[model samples]
Target: MLSSLLTKFLLLSCVNHCALAALNGHCPPLGPVLPAPTQPSKHGAVSAAATTLKGIINKTTAAYNSSAVAIGVKSIHESGFVFSYTYTPPDKDEIGTQAVDLDTVFRIGSVSKLFAPLALLKLGISLDEPITKYVPELRALKSQAREDSPVWAVEWDDVTLGSLASHMSGIPSDLITDMAPLGNLSAYGYPAANSSELLSCSGFFGTPSCNRTAFFANFGKRPPAQVPFSAQTVYSNVAFAILSFAVETIAKQPFADYVGKEIWKRTNMARTFATQPNASLAFIPVDDIWWPADLGFEGPGGGYFSTINDLHRLGDAILKHKLLSPVRTRKWMKPVTSTSSTGVLIGQPWEILRAENVTSDGRMIELYTKRGEIISYYSTFALIPDYDLVITILVAGPGTPGEVTGASMDLMMSQVVKTLLPAVEKAGKTEAKAAYAGIYVDQRTNSTITLFLDDKDDDDNDGPGFSISRYVIRGVDVPTTDPGGTTLPASAPPALDPPMRYRLYPASATTMTRTSGSGLEQGLQQRQQISWRAVGTRSRGADEVAARDAQFAWPMYSCVTWATMDRVTFGFGARDHFVFNLEDGGRAMAVEAVGYKVRMERMSPS
Candidate 1:
């Protein structure tokens, strides 16, 4: 039943924009059109943007003296815009100056956690099910309350697979603890470090005792940071380690093999590995101590090594819904819990970020991202679904600290987002012009409307929606006419003195199937039903209008714009609601004014 539900959702696309309109104040009254998945389009602007990005990567990596940095960017809208850049520092040590490419492997650190949830989901494992269902040994565990310590023994029965995946299981951050690292606890009335408190066998700390038995023994001694299902997001590497045990128990095979077969193989990520492959095949940084450390049980948590090409393939597969259904993919990408920062949230394993002001319109873009650092290897993978953009950055070198790597990645990401959005928007406008921006006329009634794309890029200067230069009903200019024969109604925008404007926004989109067509077009032809809102507005000049109306021009300019905008009504429908009659390739053949009950055929551009 669950599988069928997922399948149904996968086949369906978001049909109505009204839900988004109701939920987001930033959204227009009609809401934006539901965008379909697009392959890369041919756009020169994207190429220029890629060049700018390439320069930024080269200059920044050189400045940091990065031993090796591999970056790959793919834009869904532009096929030729795929960019890849790899840098390897000059010859040093026995290995000498080895070249790096998209396929050159590097340890991905905590980024490996991203695959664990995917594997569990593929196995049809109910994420909400208690961890004890798969790993029965956890059923015997109970919490121990301590007055002085923040840690308490985890009631594993209370922890679900989802909680473990999302870092909300309240599991302790790690299983291993060093007695000497505790320092003097006598001041807090706690016992001083003793032999009993010594850090024991566990793979998390690179100890040799790396089997499941040793892991469970060490875990029982450690305590959870909080109760299960806590609202707080307390990251626990051990959570994934525990998840690996559940996976192995259910599959009756090692966790690595399962992920390799199900995810990597399916996604075409041939260069990714469950563990650090031989050093000869990987681009290991010189004198890296963490490179040689065996992860053992922690391998599921932070032990995978992947290449830029592999990460790119993974990102594409996710966005394209190659493995999971579209519904499941979207749900998995969403935030599971909020963090302290309003801009940040935590998903199953994603560090989701709300990036504001990346676009010229000042709208926020959510970035589904993950960051990893193990030893001197740093990596970041992000998916910006709004723009259908994927970014992968991998760094291997001596100076790969969290701060340094973070800043570098931030620079790359910021540049990409800022540059690509405008490029994509411009490309979209160009495409829109060819398809919808033209003169539409009702020759029987001599009515006409001319639509054009706004040239101004600044939202503050002029609101950026599809602009209308002319509108006439029955040869009567509605914008300039008084409330008699030419006027729409009182509910619509009042007749303006001069400079009247109308901006069209997408309201809804639907799909229709042919029931009674014949000949070559007889076999179930599908057409897209699209509704656009004509937001008619009356104006003098901005200064003149503000001077005339004291009440409308407020200290808070258009704060209640949603209340007034797109509310124009006729008898039963919106006065300015227009529906496009699209052909096979989404070209507008004609537009119907819903309230007016009049259809206008599109006229070819002169």
Candidate 2:
């Protein structure tokens, strides 16, 4: 009973010889499949995953400035359950108006980044292989430490495909800014294309033959980018572009042809493509304004037009190990944790969400997610391997991209998962009490943050299995760097906001999320809301997880990290996560909010 959209639907019933069948087989009656709610419900029931999702869409439609969005759900056990819900944009159609549903396609930006790695993996190319082994131009280019810094030379043969995929290679963040001017830039460039304030590229949007050979040639031609190669996890759009070039160079075929045969065709993504096959593409509104730009030039990374059905097909294929081996696919989803202790990690293009006991499977479930934003569209996908569950959200804003306060995508996904598949708690584990409470201060800005576990309110829901405890935050600090090398904290001496309380729900023996709370007050990424997952330890840093029942007398899971936050706008899709540094071994030595680019030392354990 999928909303009105499930009429004559198709699901991959079996996977034999990497082939699929469409059948209406028996699926367990787990949750309610309801129609789109007129309003988004904040407190969602267990049987209302779809209803809750629709509610969220309805509430945030105006807040996020989105014109239209399509959501797809695919679950596999004995049978496959695939269904989708699409919201029609209010105004008229620019290209094909009726209302783009699961069939309508969109250029999923960095989400396309995964295809490059998958193709390489399918081609039997090892992740550890040097990228220069394929593309000779990369080997010939000089290496720079920074775009404006003195040009330094290095052996380009050292950079590997895995590093580039994981965003660990210190490639240029922007090619048009770091490299020479383009010879044949596309004329259909939108203001978002040329504006780094919005996106990374300053040249073309889609695939318009913007000269890949010449682009790679100019890499070492000038000074290097800010971060050097093999440095930390610094995001580089050019690195992905280089990966595309490498894949094409190694296969001895154009990237478009290679992916067409290798990935898309195998997944049965008929209406999908790596390039803009149609010129009269739909009007992709940014904010409320329609944005029109092609993602072709950066095809390997950003330019991919796919439909909801195709995305579900792709997810199903991955679950069935359609292209790569299970071992390879598992490795690709593993976390590449950063050294900052902020819990950030990247394996291939997927952002690893590490949590403890997030499902009933006894084993720790890791949710792999990827988010993409080009000129006109913003897309995201969350996949739970243990549950074989996948949720993909494609959004087109109907208003200004920065000004509006959209729904919290992370929270929405987390809530949907919680409602649909309630996590089994670690036996003997009680509500998380005092380990995280402390007065933490940022060293650079000399500003502080104080955490308090508050008393239960009289009017609060006290009849639950485990009573919810309020986690309060008092002081907030923000730092910014000047044009010079000196760093400056915002001059407004930070005052404590009326204590912001986020209800903490215990996931396992040691993990808690802001899933039950209202999240943060202000001054973080998007600052709209901050949904957090905290994993505490008595040791210095996060320890490796063996298995669920193996008995973690010590550390629980690996990490629950966050992506970097935006300084100017706090869109709040991803988190600006904080990590506790334990030096005394029992309590934290310091707390590092890595995504916000600040570190706070613990004064004393409360």
Candidate 3:
């Protein structure tokens, strides 16, 4: 009997368009809907995949001629799913190359931008507040500007902490060019070192020679990239520097000290520091021209060094919402402004990328990501909220030609996300099947339905939802019953015919009270109510579908399923909705087909 049931499931598509009318005649309740969790599993398969992926990474890192690379992957929902890979160049050097590992620290460069906003968020500082309120030096700079200065002069009073963090402050990208290579001034057309047209903080070595006093003294004279509050996302290292100063002033502690106590310490990122750590523990690339130099005021912008293990901890902390309240974290993760590209968005310090075709159903996934580079080092990390996944890549060596380091980072990101997202989706489906795939029956009404997740390798077998393997209503096989557009009453009968297909997608889940029984039985019985959207397919052949599509010039004509997906409504609620009463561990005890006005209890385990 079990083998026969399995064979029936294998042969079926789902419920067809004809069966939908029988199931969706009434209305379903309108309750809150939430995103389904991507239940990541702690399975050996992922680890084995990672092991294979690491080999590809090793070849790519070596091909880029990187001195060393460290990468880490963590699953937020699943314990024992941490993965790390390290690669060191085969060539030896006179400076003595130390073998790098997960614990060996590397300069994370501009990735430090992440900490400034996090610290301010922790302090309960209003992001909309003008930055000048805390960084009075900015106010001084605005006041000192000439009355006849260009219209692009930054309006410090109008710039807010939010704007700075989101790279919309319209400030200059750099305050000093000390990092720029020194060259003959006369050959480039005439600026002597003493000329006021040139910044006094010139020359390499002692060049960033500009202290806080000299930095602010000469900063006012520099022209702004755009007027304050302009709809421009200018990548400004100086903006983060100014934001750090504001943070320090408000927290009444140095920026580094504040973050150390509030962020790094709390997140257990022990190896992550605002300044370069001890050389013995760090992988300082051998580069005389752009060696590890103190960023001075810009330390908060791009000076932190961290190990792979610390980054994993930080990512885990952010995903688990251990660093901020759930509400605030959600707010923080969203885009502050949209960019010119449809697939790109700008958040506080995030470069949000909208990835497509990562799943079998072609759903878009938004990745909250950050990239950093400083001379010889490169770093990037992407946090995928949909999959509860985090991936970090750090590279250090002499800068490679053709920007190979960047290409290597992109390769790692695209490949890992492509591989892991589907794995995570499959894992979530596996978990869902165990919890929800079963027979539900209303014995009194003689209605029964069998639901199961399609684990078939062929994507064309069904839609990206739970398949209705078997469905019957009032002793009538609904899938096989062809009403031929005739509205049959709940108690009416229709002869069984050819079968059709249907699938159910999750809509919402909420806790509600059962007001049925009395006393203890009705004591505010809390059960999770989950609504599913039932969708049915037309039994059309591929040749007919192709002919119909060829006639319509518009592409949406071929994709009108979404038009009636959740829009249809009846007297009580949404049509084709099923509300499942869930127990702990997300197990469904019973289900109610609201549109059908029928409640069914879960059948006993097979």
- Give me the candidate number with maximum TM-score: 3
Per-prediction TM-score to the true structure, in the order listed: 0.76, 0.55, 0.77
Off by over 4 Å in 2: 1-47, 62-66, 78-83, 143-154, 177-209, 221-231, 279-283, 286-292, 339-343, 355-364, 398-411, 423-606
Q: Write the per-residue lDDT of candidate 1 for residues 465-542, one digit (tens) a residue.
A: 466777887777766752422345576545557545566766642434444478886766665568777655443323
Could you tell me the TM-score of candidate 3? 0.77
Clashing pairs in 1: 40-79, 41-77
Worst 10 residues of 1 by lDDT: 16-25
lDDT: worst 10-residue window of model 3: 25-34
Shift of residue 177 alpha carbon in model 1, Å = 6.8
Kindly give the number of clashing pairs for every candidate.
2, 26, 7
Better of 1 and 2 by lDDT: 1
TM-score-based ranking: 3, 1, 2
Model 1 C-alpha lDDT versus the unseen true structure: 0.68
